[model samples]
Target chain A: GIQVEQSPPDLILQEGANSTLRCNFSDSVNNLQWFHQNPWGQLINLFYIPSGTKQNGRLSATTVATERYSLLYISSSQTTDSGVYFCAVENIDQAGTALIFGKGTTLSVSS
Target chain B: DTAVSQTPKYLVTQMGNDKSIKCEQNLGHDTMYWYKQDSKKFLKIMFSYNNKELIINETVPNRFSPKSPDKAHLNLHINSLELGDSAVYFCASSQVNPANTGELFFGEGSRLTVL
Candidate 1:
């Protein structure tokens, strides 16, 4: 029951542009996360990276996890970075559970 | 100072109503999470409490019930409420085993509206 897929479901950048957001998982993952739901909804957790890279400022994340996929990088963006961007997974057959989300990636950073 | 604090930020019940949603974590976390954001946002993960026990229970039905009296509280009880139980409910915290390793610290969402 692990299937998280998120890509440019919708995105529109302007203010000091720079972006890349993707997450695709169908299997193997102990845990992985990246969230930012702003615009008043408030989710904000930007990256737990169950595998590799991490930055956090202008934000950055990369979790290759042997190709299961994950990448979220937003360089000079602003306007509070707009909204919605989630990618969560906790597979590996779900032991030590809960976390399976990805149906988001709706940023609109315009300045 | 609000590591994770959830409450009745909004909840409007009706249809055979029975509601309860309250979670708190001052970061002394031992693990506590319950997420459900529908209405297209779709971030789902029902219950998960680590110190007060009850470790994850997805599929979430049984009229939904999750209660953890210690380890910083985890409470969500929803009985007859319907209309798909509306949406938006998030409360999170981390740190427990194999290093739950930072990051999850959300809780500014409650917005339920069953009608």
Candidate 2:
């Protein structure tokens, strides 16, 4: 089983601020995804970057597969961004199977 | 439209009871999974089904059984529920492709409280 570790287990920021969250895996992965669990407990897929970079709205993510790490950035955050961010990975050996998730990073944004 | 949906968004039961949660995905995905999120928010995979066949069972208790009646539905049944089983359970679905495993779409979690 591949190990996924997320940094800054807890975060608090004022609205309109910027922040970055990181995820480090223990092995090469064929599938890497970032998810945001809103206050209502719905897990929303933020990114599916096994490698490279992508951006959507105020969110962006970069994955360095070779380095076994990924970073998620949020610029000018809003109260809606307050929730838990999760990093999930499927190791190469997993071969399209279930993804292993890291302990999430809880984010609180106050306006 | 909701890509994935789970019924009985909240369940509260007593010990020794048996309950079931139903999940359905309309994304036409080939794989579906069940994950448990504990109080500390640690998410762990409990079971995965590929094309309605059991593919991964992560040492989950025998009391926990998952059934996929078809490619679009996977249901979880838990018997003799204990307090430890109290947690939020999520249902997710994804397309399993060699080139890229598509992003998993998850349903609003089902919160189970075993008293």
Candidate 3:
């Protein structure tokens, strides 16, 4: 079984501030995804970067598979972005393709 | 149209009751999954089904059973529910390919509260 750990378990920032969340896994992964759970509890897919880097609007993510870690950046965050960010990975060595999720980083953006 | 949808967006029941949550995906994906998110917001995979066949079954209790009637639908049934069974059950789907494992699309989630 693989392990996924997220850093800065809790975070708070002003509406215009920026932040970065980190995720570290214990094994090589074939699939990695970043998700944002909104305040209403809806899970929104943020990125599916198994490797390399990708950006969507004010959000960007980079995954260094060789290093077994990934970073998610939110620029000029908004109050609507306040919620939980989760990183999930499916180990390359595992038989099942279930994505193991990190505990998540709770973000609170205050206007 | 919603890509993935689960019914009974919210459920409240008493202990020892039986309940079921139904999930359907219109993305034409081959794999579907059920995930449980606890009160603390910690999400974990409970079951995974690929094309109507069971592929992954975590250490979930026997009371929790997942049934996939077809490739596009997966449903979860829980019996003798306990207080610990109270959580947000999410339905997700993805297409698996050799080149890349598909990204998952989660439903709005079904929140179950046991009394």
Candidate 4:
């Protein structure tokens, strides 16, 4: 089984600030995704980046498949951004297309 | 319209009780999954179905059974639930693409509380 570890287990930032979250996987992955679990317990898909970089408004993500790591960036964060950010990956060795998720980085953006 | 939807957003039951959570996805995806998130907010895949066929079954107990009557629906039934079973259950769906494994879209979680 592949292991997914997210850094900065917890983060707090003032509104309008910028932050970065990191995820490291123990093995090569065929699929990688970023998700945001809002305070309402809704898991929203942020990005699906397996090996490249992509930006979605104030949120962007980059995955270095060779390095087995990914970075998620949030710029000019707003108070509504408070929640947990998760990084999930599907290992190449995995039998099915199930994703193994990281513990997640809890983010708090205060206005 | 919701891409993925689960019934009974919240459930409260006593230990040993049996309950069922229903999931449906209108995204026309071929794969559906059930995930559990514990109090620590750690998410883990429990089961996955591709085109109404069981594809991935983790080390989940037999008490937890998942049924996919069709590709668009997957239901989870828990029998003799224990206190430890209390957690948020999420239903997700994705389309398998040749270019890469599909990205998962999760529904608003169903929070279960076992007394």
Candidate 5:
């Protein structure tokens, strides 16, 4: 089994601020995705970046597969973005079958 | 359209009861999975099925059984549940391909409580 670690287990920010969350894996991965779980407990896919970078609205993510790390950036964060952010990866050996998730970074955005 | 949907979004039962959660994916993905999110918000894979066949089975207890009748459906059945079994269960589906990042689309999650 591969290990996935997320930094800054908890975060709090005022609305309109910016922040970055990080995820590190213990091995190489063929599939990597970032997800945001809203207050209503709905999991929304943010990015599917096994490598390279991707951006969507105020959310963006970059995965440096060779370094075994990925970063998620939130620009001008909003109250609706206050929730848990998760990074999950599938080991190359698994053949992109299953995903191993990090503990998640809990984000709280206040107005 | 709801890409991935699970029935009984919330479930509460006694310690010795048996319950089942049903999941269906209309995305037509070849692989479906069951994941458990604990109180600490740690999501772990419980089971993985590819086109109605079991593929990945974690070190979960035998009391937990997952059945996939077809490619579009995967159901989880828990027997003799205990208090420790209380957690949020998520049903997800993805297109499994080694050449691409298999992004999983998850359901709204089923919150299970054992009293």
Candidate 6:
């Protein structure tokens, strides 16, 4: 089984602050995805960047597979962005079947 | 048009009881997965089904079983539930092709409390 670890288990940000969330994997992975568990408990897919950078509005993610790590950027955070951000990876051991999720970075955005 | 839908958004049961959570996907995906999110918000894979066949079953206890009657439905059954079984259950579906990038669409998690 592959191990996925996320950094900064807890985070707090002001309405206009910027932050970066990181995820480090112990082994090579075939896929990586960033997810945001909103206040309503809905798991929203943020990005599917397995090895590159992608920007979606105030959110962006970069995955450096060679280094076995990934980063998620939240620029000028909003109250609505307050939730848990999870980085899930599919490693070679599973043949890209299941996702091994990290503990997640709990982000709290204040007004 | 929810891509993934799960029934019984919340379940409260006593220990030693049995319960089931049903999941259905309309995204035309061949793969469905069951994940459990613990109190500390760490999600772990419990089961994986592809085309109605079980593919991956993590070290999940034998008390938990997953049944996929068709390509669009995967239901989970838990026997002799325990207090430790309390967690949020999430059902997700994704296209099976490797090129699909393993992007999963999850359901509004079902919060289960085993008292």
Model 2: residues >4 Å from true position, as ranges?
Answer: none
Poorest 10 consecutive residues of model 5 chain B by lDDT? B95-104
Residue pairs of candidate 2 with colliding backbone atoms: none
The DockQ of predicted model 3 stands at 0.81
lDDT of candidate 2 over A58-110, digit per residue (tens): 99999999999999999999999999999999989877778899998999999
lDDT of 5: 0.93
Per residue, candidate 1 scores C-alpha lDDT tens digits across B20-85 of: 999999878788989888888888878888889988787888998989999899999999999988
Per-residue error for B51 in candidate 2, Å, reads 0.9
Whole-model lDDT per candidate: 0.86, 0.94, 0.95, 0.93, 0.93, 0.93
Candidate 1 C-alpha lDDT tens digits along A11-72: 99899989999999988997898988888999887778889898978888999988999999
Across residues B10-63, which tens digit of lDDT does each residue of candidate 3 receive? 999999999999999999998999999999999999999988999899999999
Tens digit of per-residue lDDT, candidate 5, span A1-111? 899999889999999999999999999998899999998989999999999999999889999999999999999999999999999998988775698999999999999
Tens-place lDDT per residue, model 2, B24-45, is 9999899999999999888899
lDDT string, candidate 4, B4-60, tens digits: 999989999999999999999998888999999999999999999988988889899
Instruction: Give, for candidate 4 chain B, the lowest lDDT window spanning 10 residues.
Output: B94-103
Q: What is the lDDT of residue B95 in candidate 6?
A: 88
| Two-chain DockQ for each candidate model | 0.32, 0.91, 0.81, 0.85, 0.91, 0.89
Query: Model 5: runs farther than 4 Å from truth?
Result: B97-101
Give the distance in Å from residue A37's predicted Cα in candidate 6 to where it truly belongs.
0.6
lDDT for B58 in candidate 5 is 90
Q: How many clashing residue pairs, candidate 5?
A: 0
Residues A1-111 of candidate 4 have per-residue lDDT tens digits of 899999999999999999999999999998899999999888999999989999999999999999999999999999999999999999887735699999999999998
